[model samples]
Each structure stands twice: as C-alpha cells, then as structure tokens.
Target: MTPSRRAVLAAGATAMAAPALAADPVSLARDERHWARVAALFDSPPPGVIQLENGQFGAMTRATRAAYEQKLARVNRETTLYTRRGALQDVQAVRAKAAAFLGVDVDEIAFTRGGTESMLVLIGGYSRLKPGNAVLYADLDYDSMQVGMESLARLRGVRVVRFALPEPATRQRLIDAYEQALKANPDVRMMLLTHLSHRTGLIPPVKEITALAKARGVDVLLDCGHALGQTEFSLRDMGVEFAGLNLHKWIGSPLGVGLVYIRRDRIRDIEISILAEPSDAIDARVHTGTVSYASVLTVADAFDAHAAIGPAAKARRLQFLRDRWAETLRDHPRIQVLTPPDPSLHAGITSFRITGQTSLGQALELKKTLFERHGIFTVERPGAAKGACIRVSPSFVNTVDHMDALVAALKEIAA
Candidate 1:
C-alpha cells in the first residue's frame, strides 16, 4: 500500500486499540529479534543512500507521523472551536507528561517551537547580567545558541567570553577547563553548557560542571537539545535550574515541538518575553505566538512511543551503532575518530577527518563523494580546532549492515 494509505490504516488501528509497547528492556538488549521489531516501528528512509544524519533531525516513527496527521485533521475540522474549548486542557496534559518525563515539577515546563527558540528565549531574557558582568560559551555549543549568547551580551551590556574545549577531552579535563574559566572570570554571571556537543558528540560532565558553576555563584543554562531523548537522564539527575530541550530530535516528536524548563524558585531570574498577565510561572517567560496546536498536542504520542522502547535500551542501541563503525575504522592510517572512545563521553554522533583534508571545502567535498560514490549521506561540522570533519549520526533504525557499509566506504576513500 502507498504510504499515505498505510498511515490512514495505521491511524484507524491505533484509535481502535492502542498499539503494543516496545519489547521488554532485557529482551531488547540481548535479542536482535526484539531490536528488529523496534526498528520496524519507523518507516524506512529513501532507498538509494543510507541516512546516518539523524542527529540533525530524526524522522518520526510510523505511529508518530500518523497520529500527528490525525490530530492536524481534527484541528482543521474543529477550527477555532477546538482552540476555544479544548486546546488549553490538552496542552496542560502534555505539559504534565513532559514534566514527569524530565522528573521536574509541572509548573516548570513551557513548550516552544524548537530547540533554537527555547534557547533564544532563555538567553535573551535572562535578567541578571550587568555592564561589567560576563557570560561564557564554548566552541562546542550549537551555532544558533552561540549567536543567542552574543545577542544577550549586547543587550545586557555584558562581555562575552569564548573558549575552546580541550582538543582531546576527558571527563576531568572538561570540568577543569570550566572551573578555570569560572575562576579566571570571577565576574561571569552565567554560562551556557551543551550537555552533548553537536559538533562531535561529546557528552560533558554536566552534573559536575553544574556543581562547579553553582559553587562559584554562576547559573548554567543547559542546552540539552541533543541529550534529552538520546541518553537517559532527568532534571534532578543533572541538578540544573534552567534548560532547553528538543522533543523533535531524540523524542521523535513532530517537527516544531520543543520545551523549556525553569525551576519554580528560579522563575524570577528570567524576564518575560511576551506582554501578558503578570505571573511567575515558566510559561509566562515563553512567547511563541500562534504555534501549531496539532504539533504540540501530538507530543503525547511521541512520549508514549519513546517510553515504550525505554531510554536505557535506546542508549545501548545508539552507542552500539557508533562503536560498530568507530571500532572498524579506528586503525585506518588516515582516519581519526573525533569523539573519544570512552562510553561516558560519546553516543551515536561521531566525526572524523581525513589526515590531510581539514578545510571546509575538503569536508564538503568528502560529504559529496560519500553520497555520490558510496551511497552514504553525512554532514560537515566546522569550528573544530583541528579542522572541519564530517559528522555521522545514526538512530535505532540503522542496522549493523548499514554500519558495515559505512566502514567499507571509509576504508576505500581514506586509503
């Protein structure tokens, strides 16, 4: 059947009887049969090239996409009636679900368009910086987030301090750099921490870094857009007071669904972006005008599907895929794995550069060569001190055979 018709049939089936949850966690870990069943939940990508760029945007599962379409249809039919009568309650329900998923209080969560929007709201509205106060962000932070911080510095009249993460980073070395920066810039009032670097998939020691910042009287705005659904953790686990997350990335929610969290007591620290009724609630600080009600409402379905597979199981599968390819090419004479092999520091996303090819042109050309010559798709990320490198990010849908193909391509191209 065609994909549209299949989606309609799947929607009807789901409405009649809830689809079963993913296989049990233990079984999912040890049994390929169970993993294959979970993989079947997603629609296969286009036939020609292997898609290993899920970190940029993960396509929704068959169930999630169908549910989103059904919701959109319902909203279009009901029109303003649904918005007037039922939208607020529906949104509140999803907000509560999101809070529970993050182990945060319901009042602390606010939905935004996506990760970039969430970050912009927090960085632009934070109220504590002054003329001489400083803010810090590292090279590994997302490009949009780095821009937001720069805007914040201009608006708040605070100096912006930029730093580079250790080229070959370890958990301790990462913490030490942050601590040294904080100590050196005693006037720094806020720091932006990317829980997982998008450039090279570096998982920093967030809890440790948060603690270090807190001890020095600095507040940390965590950009967890890539961390939330990919790895297992909670708000309490990270000990953070403010954060921005993307459900569309790892949660596999429909595009345009993201969240911002402000601890109940810390709500006063962020200025309200939209002119609305005076309140201290987290939602008051976020002003995403006329968002897609359908996308926000369907987030509950994404949550349901994510929970079914379980975060622990998902983490294992992503790491396994990363390791499968990394280990295969580790000994290649011209290949250098940018992400550290330590499980604590890396996940599915990994980058590598050809020994002598480090320019942006080289990286882009390599990406094109992989797609045209080897039927593989990847992306180039800039700002690495060493040079630009191609990034590969695989999801649960990718298979061992896919990684084997990537390994084979690298072996021939890098040789």
Candidate 2:
C-alpha cells in the first residue's frame, strides 16, 4: 500500500469499539483507549487542525449528521404539507423528549433558534421589573446576556448594577461575593447568573447563589447556554425559575436548536410578546418565524448519541481532557490558568492567559500564534473581568494527545 494510504488505515483502526465500560465515568475518563474509540464516532475534523475551541458549538457525529440530513430531506420533500399539518405534533414529540432529558415539565419548555434566542425571549419579556428597581449581573455573565440586562434597564426603567466575581474564587467565596452584592444593592429585584462563564469557563455555585438571591427576593434569569450537556445536574435543583439552554454546544446537535425554560409556576411572569401566538403554552413565548425543521427534529438523534455515552461520562470525559493540559501547564511561570482546581467549580471548558498579556489584542495574537504556527485551533474570549483570556473547550472527540499538543505548543510559545 502507498505510505499515505497506510497512515489513513492506521488512523481508522483506532476507531474500534470502546472496551467494556469502566465501573464509573471518573475511571473511564482517564482511559484514553475508550475515548479514542468514542472520538471515532464523530466524523473527523480537518486533518491538520486540532479543534480546542469547542465552546462555540459542537461537531456532529456521523450518526447525527446522517439523521439531520434525512430529516432535512423529509422536511423539504413534505414542505409545509408536513409543517402546516403534522409538524407541530412532531415538534411536540421532540419537546416531550427534551423535557424528559432536562427533567422538566413539558409545558415549561419552548423551542428557539438557539441559546441566544432563548436568552432574548426571556430578557425581552420579563414582566416583573418596574421603574427604579435594579437588575444585577456579574462581569463573568455572557456578553449578550449583559446587553440584554442593559436593554432591560432602559425598557423597564430598572437600574443596572454590574459587578465582577472575585478572580481565583472558591465555592464559599463566590457565595459570599453574591451575598455582599445583594446586600449592597437592595433595590436589585432581578439578576442574571451564568451557570458556566463562557469567558473563563468558571462554573459558579449556582444553587447557593440562587438561594442568596431568593432570600433577598431577587428573581434570577439564568443563562445556562453552556451548562446543560457540559455538566450533569438537575436544572430544577439549581432553583432558578428561568433559564436558556442549547442543544448545539455540548449536546452535539446540529446548530439552530435550543430552548427557553421557565418553572411551571413562573410562566406567567414572562409576558406573551407579539412574536408569539398569544397562547399560554410556553412554546408561544418566542417565535422566530420558520425555524429549521431538520435542526429541531434531529434533536432526538442527538439525544441518542448523548445518552449512549451518558451525561456523567460525557462531562467527566470532557473535564478529563481539560485537566490533562491545564494541570500540566498550571505551574508554568508565564502561564496563568483561569479556572481553579476546585472540581466543583469547573468542567469541560477552561481558559488561560500568558502572564502580562491580558489585553484583547494580546489574547488574539496568542490565539493566532497557536492556530497558525502550530495548527492547534483555540479562541480568544474577551470581557473577562480580570483580563482577556483564551478559552479552551474540548468535546468527547478530543483525546489526551490533542491536549498534549496544546500543552507543548503553549510551552514553546511561552518560552
């Protein structure tokens, strides 16, 4: 065989079935052999690039892509014949499945284009705030969410209070910070809490902070865009009445799929906007007009892949990949790891900055160097309260080797 063909064959051989499952996902996480097999389930990325910037969205597995294409073809073939007739029923079926996956009431969830759309729906329609009331958010909250809250200030005549969570924060310290903020801003009747900070990949203590907010009578509109599939948690347990979630990120679905969730009792708090059909169903809260039928329907297939590995395993596997590189480089003098070692405070996503290079331009340059010089893809996340950072998110498709490559590249660059 030709040399190139032999190399391709060798690579394909690693895609063999994962060995019998480990007793638990934590143990399974360190088993590179199992992850390599799992990685093979996803169609490969381009040959040369190591895709570590997975926070933006997830890659489709072969099975998911096939299912998506088939759904697409079916939707096209039937056109509005299916959409105008049986589509809502089909969507309801999918909604039931999504609700079960989230452990939420089916009536509480509504589909939207993606997490951003879901956020917009919740922020724009929040009906509880009145003039002179204050809405609080942190620096680590997602950018679009911050903007939404700012717009809410104008629309509702509420005061906007933005604070920065303590860098290098711990579970107790985080809660303390929120408690202090809530006490300091007495008029704060609403707040935004991001389950996972997209900028620094810091998973805050949502439950405890939500408790603090509740004691102060602050209604929380949570931005859970990156948390749903990235971490294993019961959304209800978080005690937030409102949230936005995405299927396209950690869930590995095709893009343009996400949902808005309001606890059943709180549904009345979000005013039914004109975009909706003026119905009481949660689905009527946000209508973007003609969503991609294929993207919505194929969530069933995505959930298949998600459940095959299971949420705990997927989360552990992702954190495993992250830990490998982050732990390795944490001690480097010139490198600063943003996510703390607190296992509860971090998961799949993490961010870091080269010492003293904390500006957006510097972060972009570092990202460019990693991409162009070493063929390792990473993304620069601006708006970190302390500094700009390069965010790294790994999917199940990534293995220890990809992380090792990133470590080696960063070490060389820092040197």
Task: Tell me the whole-model lDDT of each prediction, alpha carbons only.
Answer: 0.85, 0.86
Residue-wise C-alpha lDDT for candidate 1, range 91-141, written one tens digit per residue: 899989998888898998899998888888789879888899999999889
Give one digit per residue, the lDDT tens place, for model 2 in 297-339. 9898788777766678788888888899999998999999998
Task: Report the lDDT of model 2 for residue 93.
Answer: 97
RMSD for each of the candidates: 3.1, 4.4
lDDT of 2 at 74: 83
lDDT of 2: 0.86
Q: Poorest 10 consecutive residues of model 2 by lDDT?
A: 13-22
- Highest lDDT, which number? 2
Q: Candidate 2, 131: how far from true, in Å?
A: 0.8
Q: Residue 384 error for model 2, in Å? A: 1.2
